[model samples]
Target: MREISLDRLRTLVAIADLGSFAEAARALNLAPPTVSLHIADLEARVGGALLSRSRGRITPTAVGETLVERARRLLVDAQQALDDVQRQVQGLAGRVRVGASTGVIAQLLPQALERLGQRHPGIDVQVAVLTSQETLLQLAAGTLDIGLIALPQLPVKGLDIHPWRRDPVMAFLPARWEPPAVVTPAWLADQPLILNDSSTRLSRLTAEWFASDGQQPTPRIQLNYNDAIKSLVAAGYGATLLPHEASTPLPDARISMHALAPPLWRQLGIVHRAGDSARATAHVLDVLWEQGVE
Candidate 1:
């Protein structure tokens, strides 16, 4: 029996995760025919079919499922081994994959990465901007070295979350619209709102706060990008509620921010797999924690 090469194992794992040969090929930067050939060769070596294809969906056979589980562990171990060697020779030279929610990516990660790059020029940082839930999922899957996300009221399983910063939520008002001296939830609800889309954790938390108060502001518009929302408010489209980071330095002279009466705040943090043994990941976490404190 021939041993499975790391490249072939990675191809198999990607196919299983993505559920299609074409997608797996794209991910690995290999032609679709090459992906198919690798899988066929692996199946021959293993003496059984690995995937069952029908209706544009590929399902793993029992043996395929078992192989996938083992392959994932093997791949992680292989990467970790490489990381260990790279650290000794080059001192934090390997790439670190990080995931973060849209808010953190916009407000926090840029400065943090700038400082990290200054300290460790050899380390390469790759970032993925995703929703909070998607960030958590990617972190758990070992695809991301770390995740920056909003702290939900409840904790997630199989992850270690460290509180990094607390940012106050602020109300965005059009430049022409004079906001109340002290904005309350009730007062803010009375205005036409340009709100964050419901897909975000901030939006959900804001919605829950409104639900608790038995008030629902009819949205004049819903948007996901903080910068775009700010631009719209500046254009006199509508007011929005956002974290202080997003509301600060009003791009247009007409826009202003007022603190909420109750002073709502959101906690942001660094999260990672509960017991990641990779030293590079640990170093990157330390760098983030240090930058976050500044």
Candidate 2:
């Protein structure tokens, strides 16, 4: 009996899932003949045919089905073992992958990451700019170590969430449309509005706020990008509502921010995989919280 290689098992699994040698080969970026050779070698070692082939479709035989089941478990164990070894050797030297919403990253992460680099020079940090919803999904999928996101109304299962900061939502008014007194939602709504798209949590919240008040403010323009919305508002195209942190002081002097009287606030938080036992992730979280507090 010969030892089976991990690559051979992976190829087998890929072929089984894809159901064709050519498809599996394309998926694995290998030639079709190489995939056939791997399966053949595995069958020779097992002393039984593992696949039934007809007209280019491939289905696993009885033994092939059994081996495929075991192969999946073996592959998972192998990956866990590799992660363990890398965790031990690198300790905190490898990459710490993080995801954050654009608003959070713009307001928070850059300074935190800079300070973290000063402290732990060995650890590499990679950040993916993602929406709040996308950040949560990526964290759940183990693609990200940490995510900075808006606080959800309901707690997300299988994640540790830490409340970080609460920023008040403010109205961005064009210089020409400045009101003599405090801004009212109804008054603000009457002007041409540049609003965030429906896909964003912020947009949803804003929509609900208007609906609850029985007010329907037709947006003159709908935009998804924060910068674009801000630019349009500053150019006197329309007024917008956004978190105070998301609104930067414009050098053009056309954009002015006013605090809402009733005070709508967006809570920001740091989310991580629940019970994740990675030191690099912990360190990054610490740096994030420290920077947020300052």
Candidate 3:
């Protein structure tokens, strides 16, 4: 047997409410013949007479009452589901999955999210800590909605990348060391350094900076977490190179920060799928861009 359509269900519900085929047709903006055909088709499919004429008034039979009750709930649920989708399309409410480096997440993303929450309280941003390379991979794989990645990266197909921020990479030294006002690559290279792991783009950037001065001294240790690197630097383990976001607080009193003599900068970019973005994702992208320099 063919299944009954929502239109027939609606016609039944309307007739049960209005108690006349002509009244239901008028209310539904359907012709009288269409209304009669709908009831006939629905009864044929369900194998039951759905209406009764009693004392010149039309009313539902037992089967019709049960079907109408269930149909009402289904119609209400379907309408609600459409409304939720419309809200997401309007950027009024939805979840956005975003990927970024731990450093950026720690320093930059919080402020951006805070502002986003204020402007769009209904939007929930889900943040993931990922490397620049990992972030690009996630965005390409359709697992992520947005990415904040290190710059100077090779292009990835099917992704759109936009330069977002350029913050000077600074040398973080133990305060007790009495370092120079501006740290040259040679000066930092000669010290015991806590550096990002060789696999990271920042590590490559820092390594290139050192090589420009013909210096490539080995680090005391390599680590991927920036906050952990800072903690080690504070313990007087060694000095390190890291980007210092303008809005972030300076390191603890035990650590001192100085600009690179040659002015090395850690560039960052925003990435997303290369097409029209979902409204919620677009709203998040706007908030992230607001945190960076124009």
* Predicted structure with the largest TM-score when compared to the true one: 3
Q: RMSD, model 1, all Cα superposed?
A: 15.4
Tens digits of lDDT, candidate 1, 129-235? 88778888887777887988877635778889888877777787987787768887787788888888888878887887677667888888887788888888888
Residue ranges of candidate 3 with Cα displaced over 4 Å:
1-3
- Where's the lowest-lDDT run of ten residues in candidate 2? 244-253
Q: TM per model?
A: 0.66, 0.66, 0.89
In candidate 1, which residue pairs clash? 175-254
Encode model 3's per-residue lDDT on 117-209: one tens digit a residue: 898999989989899889999889999999999887889999999999999899999999977777898788889999999778899999999
lDDT of prediction 2: 0.80
Rank candidates by TM-score, best first: 3, 1, 2
